[model samples]
Target: MRLDERIVPYLHMAGLYHLVRLNETWFRSDESLVSAFMERWRPETHMFHMPFGKCTITLQDMAYQLGLPIDGNYVSGCLMDFERYIKGGHPAWMRFEELLGVLPLANCIDKFTVKCSWMQETFGKLPHGVNDATVKRYARAYTMMLLGTQLFGDKFGTCLHIR
Candidate 1:
């Protein structure tokens, strides 16, 4: 089977996991996994995070500081490898930094199942097959994958987590 076709099952799983934990806050007020990941990549590129108030810090806050829409859903940057991609085109256009927050790998099963499922769901929901007006109205939702951060994990080890 083609790679895209094979990825569906995992994406479905990710979607399921996402649904199960829709209200769960996965970040902390201090240095966290997501922060660490951002710090690791930020210095390597043009991205930078601005400081904010509140003892509480989360992806949404970080996204806001980085210029991403705090209201949009996130997908794994790893999905860029797929042949089919929807470039965001809208009022709440998803920014490159918005996708910087990737789905975490809890275990091998979580990596291939939960995370992939979420990415698949997000991809399917991307704006497509619409009229010109609709397209123009939602330009930000149709972001091109030409420029995106790629998520990678250790290939030689079986630790499961990307870090």
Candidate 2:
């Protein structure tokens, strides 16, 4: 199947209506909003929205499209990995914590840290050439966008930098 066909459906599935609407409002080009969202959203979480529903298009699906099995749980695993990555003194974690517009939940942070450590130890194998710093920033920005989308929806306009 075509890449766009595969992804557009997922965007629709992931309940990213706001994101799609944002693309229409902000960027008046025929560009791939899904690609932009993936690049800007949580790059670590290998999931995107379907073009028509609230289901997610996972990296496993993409891998399957490339003739592999959808056997890995990389996306969900990454969430925990991220918690550890943050606990490990990733500068971007500080930035993200600030950007979320909420004071760090001290108790939650501690708990999350332990969970993240377990995830890292379990699925911690690194991908080749994955720069830690770049991943950190991207994860932060993606997280910001995800939260911002939830908080503001389409009501806040361009007050948040989505691009």
Candidate 3:
């Protein structure tokens, strides 16, 4: 709900303004329909055995539906190396705290994980008359939330890796 507009340029620079815009729009979903699909899904084949035929949603379909660009530099890498480096000397949680200016609650987290609600609570509102640095920080946090919740959501559901 906090579309500060100041973050527009930052989001644009990072190639994520379109995704952030989607947050403003209303999207309706049917739980029963989704449950039906889930029931018909064959994870081994990555397809749905519907009554009519086998079907699978392709990346192209998702890209089109989500208004995402199809062509971009292929992103390939692992965070394992970065995590190793971080663990070697730099304290992971300390670094995370330094960057985000907050610590995850112990009861709700394992490893460098924070709840999405915590992110919304912490950075959902921007302070009045803040400087460029603060705006950039907010933009970074917003991008992280978008990626964690929208693009790369996993079994963790509401929790996301802070690293």
Best by TM-score: 3
Model 1 spans > 4 angstroms off: 1-61, 77-81, 84-163
Report the lDDT tens digits of candidate 1 across residue range 1-163: 0123333343344332222121225422333655554554443444544454223346776555444444656555443332233354311113222442333334423422223333334443434465554332222211221011121223222222211
Worst 10 residues of 1 by lDDT: 141-150
- Alpha-carbon TM-score of each model against the true structure: 0.18, 0.21, 0.70
Q: Candidate 2 on 1-163: residue-level lDDT in tens? A: 0112223443444444334433334545333653455444443554444455334556566555333335544333354445454445555436444543223334324422312222223223423465555334333443334434433323322223221
Better by lDDT, candidate 3 or 1:
3
Ranking by lDDT: 3, 2, 1
lDDT (tens digit, per residue) of candidate 3 on 1-163: 3767887899899878888745636554454776677789897999999999999999899788887777877654456654555654677777776666667678757666778877888889889899988888888788878878666654444777765
Question: What lDDT does each candidate get?
Answer: 0.32, 0.38, 0.74
Model 3, CA-based lDDT = 0.74
Q: Which candidate would rank higher by TM-score, 2 or 3?
A: 3
